[model samples]
Target: MAVNTVGYTSQITAGFRAVELAHNKKPIIVDHLAQHLAGAALHTALADYQQLQQAQGPGRSLRVPARNRIMDDFVLEALQLLQQQQQQQLDGDGVVQVVHIGCGMDTKPWRLQPLLHVHWFEIDQPAVMQLKQQLLQQAGAATATAPEPGGADLGSTTAGSSTASLAQTAAASDGRSCVAPAAADHEQQQHQQGVRFPLLPQRYSAVPADLAMVPLAACLQAAGFQQQRPTVWVAEALLYYLPLDVACELLRSMRALSGAGSCLAATCIDAELQQAHLRLPSQHYFSTNKVAWHFSMDELAAAIGAAGWRMQGQPQTAAQLARERYGRETYVALYGGAECCFTAVPG
Candidate 1:
C-alpha cells in the first residue's frame, strides 16, 4: 500500500536533512540515510522546504541540520559520559540506552555509526512508525530473513533488485522516475536510484505509539527498556505540540522511568511563539495536524524541573548555536528568538 503523506512531518524532516546534505558546502549534521528513507517523497519535500527557506530568508528553516547537530552532539556526549561512568563503576558493559521520543524518520542510529555497547529505542505515532518501517524495509535497512538451504541470499542481490523494481514502479505511477532524466545511462540510475542500505547495528527498537492515547512507560517497557540502565532521552521537536499539562505529565513519566546516569536532551519553543496569532511557516503545517504549541522555554524548564530534571545550563536557541558553531547568523525573529534546545539531568 502507498504510504499517506499528508501531515507526515517525519518525511518532511527527512527531506530537510537531505536538502542540507545536498546543498550545503559543509553540512551541520550529515544524515546519509535521509534521502534514501525519504525516497519518492524527497523531491516534493525538498521543493516545499526550499520554498519555505526562500520566504523565510537567510539562515535555515525549523528543521535545520544545524539544530539537529546540537541534539546529535548531546547524544554523543551523553553516551561518552555513560560509558565513562560504567567503566568507573565496573558495570560489566551494561546497555547504554538512547530513546528518541517522536522519532520521525530520524537516521541517528544509522548515521551515528560505531555506537558500541548501546541500544536505541525510537517512539512515534503508530502510522508514523509504520511509515518509517516501510521506508527502512524498502531502503534495505531492516534485518533480512534467513534464506533456505541452496537458496540465494535474499538480503543482498535478490532484495536489491526487488526494491529497485518497487522504486521504479512507484516513480512511474507518479509520472516521475528515480532515474535522472538528464542521465544518459540507465545502469547508473539502477545503481543510484534506490536508497543505499546503511550499516545495520545489532541493537535498535522501533515502538509505534500514540503518545496522546498510550502510556509512554508501557510502550518503552514492551520494547525491552530497562529502567535501571543509563539512558539518554531525546525529545527533539516534540514537547510543544502537546497540551501544557500533557507535556509536563510526559516529562514526569520519563523521570519516573529514568535510572542513574540518565539525562534528557530536547528542543524547546518560547511562549512568545506559541501565541495563537504568530504566523511562523512551520506553525501552519503543525496546525493542520491538530497539534499546537504549549510549552515555552521557561515553561519547559519548569515542567522538566518539576519532573525531577535539572538543566545542565541555560537553554540555547537554534540561532545561538548556528552562529557559534557554523558562523552563520540568523534573524532572531525567524524562530521568534526561542532558544529551542537544551539538556537536563536527573535532579
Candidate 2:
C-alpha cells in the first residue's frame, strides 16, 4: 500500500538543521531540526499575526495568529536545547556519526559537512533515497557556476595569467564535485530519443529484511553499529506507528548497537493524545494512515530505561515549547504542539 506523508514537513527538516546551525554552537550532527524550528517560528508568527476567521469550538476559535506564536516559541526552545547538548559532547573524540533515520530532503549533510566535517549517513526507504539522489543531482547540475578570481583583472599572458587559468580550473572542478540534477536532466533529455523509463525493472535488496521480522540487535551488528564511536542516532518525527513491542526492541537495539557515549534523539506522540491535538479544523485533512504512534511519555521512558540508557535532562513538548519560548499568542488557535523531543545516553 502507498503511504500518505506530510510533503510540507519534508522541507521543514532542512530548515530545522539551519536553525540548529545558527543557534546551537556545539556540534553533533546537523540535521533539519534547525530549519524545522525556524519555519515554525516564521510560519506560526504569521498565523498568530493573521488571526484566522474560522470558529473551531466553544472557546477554541481557529486563528492563524496563535499558530505563529506556538511555532516561534518551540523553535527557540529546541535551539537552546540542541545548543546545550552539542556542548556537552563536543570535547570528546569528535568522531560524530549522525544517522538520520528515514531522513527526507535535509541539507545537514551538505551544510553541516563543511562546518563540523563529521561523517553522516541518511537512511530511508529506497524510494526516498532515490528521490534525494535525483533532487541532489538536479540541484548540482543547475548551480554549477564558478566564482570569478579575486584579481581586479589579469593583464597580459604573464605568469599571473597562468595562475588565473589554474584558479578557474580549480573552481570549475569544485563546482562539478557536487553534481546538480538540472545539468544531468539536460544531458538525459539529449540522450532521451527513442528511450522510455523502464517499468518494474528490478527488485531492491531488502536489507535487515522487513521491519516486522528483522532482529534489531543482529541487524545493528551487521551494519557495524554495535561498536561505532561518537554515534548519535536521530529519528525525527519517526516511531509512532511502530508496534509497542517493536519500539521497545528498537530501544534495546539502540543500547546494544551504541557504545558508552552514544546518544539518541527522537520525536513521538503523547500517550493520552486527544483529537484536539490534531489541531486542524478540517477533520478530513491529512492522510489517516500516517505516523502518529501515540506512545505515552511514561511508556517511552520505561522502554528507554529497560534498554540500559539514561535519560537526558528536560523534555521538550511541541505545545510547551511554543507557549514558553515564543509566547502563547504566537501560534494558530487550532495548532498545538502534538509531538516532543528526547535525548538519551548509554549507561
Highest-TM-score candidate: 1
Give the clashing pairs for model 1: 268-340, 317-339
Query: Whole-model lDDT for model 2 versus the true structure?
Result: 0.41
Which stretches of model 2 miss by more than 4 angstroms?
Answer: 1-94, 113-117, 141-226, 271-287, 290-292, 319-337
Stretches of candidate 1 off by over 4 Å are: 1-7, 39-45, 48-63, 143-195, 199-201, 280-283, 288-290, 330-339
Worst 10 residues of 1 by lDDT: 175-184
Candidate 2 structure quality by residue, lDDT tens digits, 1-347 = 12224433453444433433343344223333333323333353333323432333222212221222233233334334443555677554333345555555544333321223123444454444444444444444111121214422111111112223534433433221121223344235424532222101010111112335545443333322325445666666666656667777777776776754467776665544434344434432232344344566667776777777787776666556545644432223334334556666777
Please list the C-alpha lDDT of all candidates, in the order they appear.
0.65, 0.41
Q: Model 1 over residues 127-160: C-alpha lDDT tens digits?
A: 6766677777767664222222343221121112
RMSD of each: 10.7, 14.8
User: Which model scores highest in lDDT?
Assistant: 1
Q: TM-scores of all models?
A: 0.76, 0.52
